[model samples]
Target: MKNLPLGMNTLAKLIKQNCVYVDKTQMAWQLICQPGAFFLSRPRRFGKSLFVDTLKEIFEGNKPLFKGLYIHDKWDWTQSYPVIKIDFSDGTLQTRESLDRRIYEILFDNATRLNVTLSKGRDIPGTFGELIRFSAEKYGTRAVVLVDEYDKPILDNIENRDTAKIMREGVKNLYSVLKGQDAYLQFIFMTGVTKFSKVSLFSGVNQLTDITIDAQFGTLCGYTHHDLQTHFSKHLDGIEQEEIKQWYNGYYWLGETTVYNPYDILLFINKRAQFRNYWFETGNPSFLIKLFQKNRYFLPDLESPVVTEEILDSFDIEKINPLTLLFQSGYLTVAHTFTRRRRMMFLLKVPNLEVRIALNDHFINGYTDLVNEKIGIQDNLYTCLENGDIDGMLKVIQRLFKSIPWRNFTNNDLADFEGYYASVIYAFFCSLDAEVIPEDIDNHGQVDMTVKLGDQIYVMEIKVVDGTNADKLNCNPALKQIQDKGYADKYRGIDGVTVHEVGLVFSKASRNLIVF
Candidate 1:
C-alpha cells in the first residue's frame, strides 16, 4: 500500500518516494495538447502547485520522469524549454517597497537558474523582462512560466481595503511585465483562489483565457469521485463511506459531478478519525467574519441559497459583503447560474458539509445571540427535549417569549424567528445525534419541529399569541390551522412510528407562552 501524499506536490518526488498518486493523466494530456496562456481559479490546497510542478517537469524536457505514465510515449523528450516558476506564498512582501524588492529577488533567482547575469541598476519589471528574453535567446526556445497562489498578497489584506489595494497594485506591476513578453514565453499558467477582474495584469493582457468554468478543466484542480474510488479505495473501505460522503461530497461546479477537496480528504484518511475542520485551521477567516457582520446578513442563511451578483462580484471590502467574499474566496461555488429576465443570477450555498459546520462554529463564536443565556427564563428547552418532557418544552417556549427583546423583535423584525428557532432546535438535537427537522411539514402548515427520539416521532406546532386569554387559546383559529395544514398526513403508513402532536402559544403583550 502506498502512503498518502500529505504535502507532496512534485510528481517526480512522489513517484520516487512511492506515495499514492491519483493519475490525472487525461487532464494533463488535454492541457499539453492545447497549451496557451491559461488561468485557473480554485479553492486553496486543491493541488494547484502540484499541477504546476507537473507542467514544469513536462515542459522542461524531463522525459525520464514520465516513465510508466500516461504521456510516456506520446511526449517528445528532445524538446526542452527554460521554465520560470514563481510561488507567491513566502510571506515576504508586506509593503509596496518590500513587494518591489521581492519581485526583483524572484527575477534574480530565475535568471541565475538559466545562467543569465543581470547588470546593476535595472528596474525590477525591466530586469524580469530582460531575464525572459535572455533565457529564450540563449536556450533557442520560449520559456514556460508558472505562477502559484498568484493572489496571496491581496487575500492576506482583504480585511484592509487600502492595504489590499496597495498590494494589488504592486503585484499588478509585476504581472504586467508578462503581457509584453508573450513572444518570449512558450506557455503561461497562473493559479489563484479568487478572480479579480480589476487586476491590471488580467485587464491589460487580454490574451489569457480563464478556464475556471470550462467543463473540460473543471476537475483539473480537485479530486473527482473516480479518482477517489480508484486511488484511495482501500483507505475508504476501512471507514464508513456514508459518513464520508455526507461530510465531503456536496460541492457541485458547472452542474457537473461533485468533487472532494483533495487536501481535506487526504488529511481525514491519514488522521483515521473525523476531526474538527482541518481546512479552516490552515488560515484565519476573520475577514470573512467581518464581512458577515457588516452586511447584517444572517449566518444561518448560509445553509440556504444566497443569490445576488453584487454580493458575488465587485465587493468593496470596506463593507460587509458575504456573497462576494464567500464566492471570491472559494468557500461557496456557483451551484447554478442563469439569466433571470435579463440579469445574471447564481445560487450560492455552503460548498460541503465540512464547510457548513466550520462556518456554523465560526458564527456561533462571533455572535452573542447564538449562545444560550440564563435570564428571566427558568426552563431549558434543550434539556426538555433530551428528557422527553413535552410539557416542559411548552413552558420553556412561554418563558422565552416573555424574555424577548421587544426592541429587537418589533416592526416585523422577528420574521426570521421561525428560522432562528428551527436552527437552535436543529443544533440541539444534532448535538445528541438525534434526527431532527424544522418546518418538516411545509404542505400541511401543521408542524414547527419534528424529532425522531428513540422509536417515537414528535410533531410540534408553535404560534405567537397577540392577546391574553389562557382559556380561549384552544378556541383560537390557530388551533385549527395545524389540523388544516395536514402536517401529520405523510406519517400514516409508517408502522411503529408513533406520532404525538403538541401546540404551544406565546403572548406578544407579556411575551409569555401558554401550553395545553
Candidate 2:
C-alpha cells in the first residue's frame, strides 16, 4: 500500500510523489465532457480540493498524469489552457479587509504563475481580470477557472450572521467579475460545502450549474466502494472489511451510491488501527453544540429520519438545531430523496454506528443530566441486568427519573416531556451496554420502553400527567391498556424471562415524576 495523502491536496504532487490514488479518472473524464460553469458542494476533506487540482492539471494539459488513467485515450492532451486555481483555505478570514487582502494575494500569485507581474498595488478584481486577459493573450487559449472552498470565509463565521453576511458580500463582488468575461474563460468549476441560494453567493451568475446533486458527478468527490476494493486491495488484505465499512463507509450521495470518507479511510489504512472520530478531530465544531442548546432538540431521535428541507436548509442558527447542524457537518448525510405532490424532500439520518456513538457523546455533553450523575445508578442498572432483576431495574429507572431538574421539564407539555424522558432513558440504558428496545409494548397500545436482561425482560409503558390529574393514571382501565395491547406478549415465551409492565406519569405543573 502506498503512503496516504493525509494533508496533500495538490493532484500533481500526489501523482508525482506516487501516493495512493483512488482513481477518480472516470469522473474527470465525465466532468470534461460537460460544458459551461459548474459548482459542487461536498463535506470538507472529501477530496474537493484534490478534484479541483486534478482539473487544474488536466486543463493545463499535463499529459503525464493521464498516461494510464481513464482519459488517456479519449482526451486530446495537445490543447493546453491557462488555469486559474484560487484556493481560499489558507486562513480564516474574519474581516472584509482581510478577505480582500487574501484575494488580492491569491490573484497575484496566480499572475506570477503565468509570468505576468502586476504593475503595483492593483485592486483584486482588476488584478484578476488582468490575469485572465494575460493568460488568454499569452497562451492563445481561454482560461480554466477553479475556485475551491469558496464559502470558507462565510463558513468561518456562520454563527455570527453579520460577519458572515459581510464576507458573503465580499465573495459575491469578487465572483461577479467572472460573469461577463465568458470570452476569456473556457470553463469554470467551484467547490464548496454548502449550497447557499444563488442570491447568497452567485448573485446574477445563475449560469453556474449546481452539480452537487447531479447523479453523474455524485461520485466525483469521494471514493466509491468499487474504487476502494479494486484500487486499494493491498491495504484491505489483512483488515476486517466489516469494521472498516462501519467506521468510514456510510455516506450516500446519489440514489443507491455508497461512498467512503477518503480522509478517514486513508488515515486508518496508513496507520493500521481502528481509531475513533479521525475526521471530526481535525476541527472541533463548537458552534454546532451551541445550536443544539438553543433549540432544545431531543437528541435520541438521531437514529430516526428527521426529514424536512426547510429545517435542513434554512434552520435558524440562534437556536441550536442539532439535526441541521449534524447534516451540514457531514456527521449525517442525505439517505434518500423523494418527490411528493410536486414537492421534493430529503430524508436524513445518522450515517452509521460510528456517527451514532459520536453523536450520542456529543448530546450527553450538551445536556447536564449525563454529567455529575451518581455512579451507583449505572452500577445498579448493570447489576439488575446481570441478576435478571426486573423489579430492581424499574426501581433504578424511577430513581433516575426523579433526579432530573424539575424546572426544565415544566416548560414543555406533559405528554411531550414524558416522551423525551423515555427516549433519554432508552439512550442511557443503551450506552451502558444494556439491550433496551423502544416502542415494543403492544399491550398498553403505546409502550415507551422495554429492556432485555439475559433471561429476564422488563416491559415498560410511560405516561405523563399533571399533579391534579395524576390519580387517573393509576386506575385499572389504564393498566389494562398495557395487557390488551400485548406489550409483554412477545417476551412470554423466552425461557426464564420476567416481564414487568410499568407506567410512569409526570406532573406538567410541578415537573415531578409519578411512578405507578
Candidate 3:
C-alpha cells in the first residue's frame, strides 16, 4: 500500500510526499466555481482541515498537485489568488483576551505571507479588513479566505456561558470584516464542528450560504464508498468489505450514498485491517453525556430520534436539546427522511457499531453508576446473562441500585416507575454489547426488555410497587403477564434457541427486588 496520509492535513505536503490522494478536487472545483461565501460543519477528524488546505492550494495556483486529478484541466491555474487561511484550532482559547491576541497574530502572519505591511493603529477587525484589501491589491487578485475550526474558540468555552460569550464576541469581530470587504474577496469558506447561530459571527456575515445539510456537498469532506474502492484498493487485502462498511460507513447527510469516517478507515487499513473503535477512542464526548443527564433524556429514545429541519439546523446553546447536540456532534446521523403533511421529517440513528458501542459506555458512565461498583456489576451482569443465570442477573441489578450514592435516591423515586428500572436494565445490556429489545411489545402486552444471548432469548417483565403493600403488588400478577401474554412465545420454536421468562418486581419504599 502507498504511504497512508496518517495525521496529515496539509494539501501541499500530502501531494509532495506521494501519499494516496483521494481526488476531492471535483468538490473543491464546484465550491470555488460558485459565487459568495460558504460554511460547512462536519465532525472533528473528518478532513475539514485538509479540505480547507486543498482550497488554499487551488487558489494559490498549485497546478502540479492537480496534474492527474479530476479537476486538472477543469481548474483555471493561470489566475492564482492570494489566500488568507485562518485556523482557530491551533491553541486553546479560554478567555476573550486570548482570543483577541490569537486573531491579531493570525492576521499578522497572513500579512507577512502576502508581503503586505499592515498599519499599527488598527484593531483586529480593522486589521483583517486591511489584510483583505492589501492582499488583493498586492497580488492583483481578490483574496480567498479559508477558515478551519472557526468555532473552536467559542466551543472551547461552551460549558461556561460567560467565557463562551466573550470568546464569541472576539471571533465575531474578526469575521464581521468579511461582509464589507466582499469586493476584495474572491471566495470565502469556513469549516467547523459546530454552527453557532446566536454568535455575531454568523449574524454579521449573514450572506454565508450554509451547505452543512445540503445534499450536494455531502461527500465534500469525507470519503464515499466509491472513493475507498477506487483509491485505497491496495490496502483492502484481508479486510472483509461488508464488515468494514458496517463498522466505518453509514454517516448520512441525506445524500444518495453514505459517507465513511476516513479516520477510521485509514487506521483500520494501517493496522493490518483490524476492526477497532478508532474514531470513538479519539474523543470521549463527556459533554454529550452531561447534556443527556441534565435533560433527563430517555436512553432508549435515542435509538431513533425523529426530528425536523429546524431541529437539525438551529442548535441554540441556551436551550440545548439532546437530539440536536447528538446529530451535530456526529453521535447521531440522518438515517432516513420522509415527508408528512408537506413537512419534512428526519430520523436520526447512531452511525455505526463503533459509535453505538462506545456511546453506550459513555452513557452508562454518566447516566448510571460509574467506576468501582460499575466494573463488578457489569462484569457479573455479562457473565450471568451469558450463562443464562437470570437469578445472577437480578442480583447484579440489585447491586447496581445499591451501589448508587444515597443522595441520588433522596429525591428521585427511581424504583417507583417500571420505565426507570427497565431503562437501567436496558443500559446495562447495551453497555455489555448485548442485543436487547427494550420495551418489547408482544401479544401479551409490553414486556420490559427482551435480551438475546448465544442460544437463549430472555423476555423480562418488570413491575414496581408504590408502597410496601404486598396485596397490591403481587409477583404472581407479573409472572402471569409474561406467560399469559405469551411474551416468550415467539422465540420458543426457533432453531437452536431456548426461551426463558423472567418476572421481576421491586418495592419503591424498601428498594428490594423480588423475582418470580
lDDT of 2 by residue, 204-255 (tens): 4648887766667777877777877887888778787788777778787664
Give each model a TM-score: 0.78, 0.83, 0.91
Best of the candidates, lDDT: 3
Question: Total backbone clashes of model 1?
Answer: 4
Candidate number with the higher lDDT (1 or 2): 2
- In terms of lDDT, model 1 sits at 0.69
lDDT at residue 295 of model 3 (Cα atoms): 57
Which of the two, 1 or 3, has more TM-score? 3
Residue 65 in candidate 2 has what lDDT? 82
Model 1 agreement with the true structure over 1-516: per-residue lDDT tens digits: 788898998998888888887766667777766548888877788788899999889888888777777887877779889998888878745688887788888888988888988876988678878888999998999988889988888778776778888988887877888889988988888888776764434664547877776678777777777777888988877677677776776555563677878888889888885754777678577767655544445443444464756555453434535666676666787777778778877787667667765655555333324335432222265566656677776676555444545554445434334343444334434434445555664654536666776656666666666666778655544345556776766765697666666655555555455544
Number of the top candidate by TM-score? 3
161: Cα error in model 3, Å: 2.2
**lDDT winner between candidates 2 and 3:** 3
Kindly report which residue pairs in candidate 1 clash with one another.
311-324, 398-513, 402-511, 444-485
Supply the TM-score for candidate 2. Answer: 0.83
- Candidate 3, residues 107-218, lDDT tens digits: the string is 9999998899999878887899899999999999789899999988888777887787788788888888888998898899998987777454587774888898877888
CA lDDT, every model vs. true structure: 0.69, 0.72, 0.81
Error of 1 at 352 (Å): 3.3
Alpha-carbon error at 174 in model 3, in Å?
Answer: 1.9
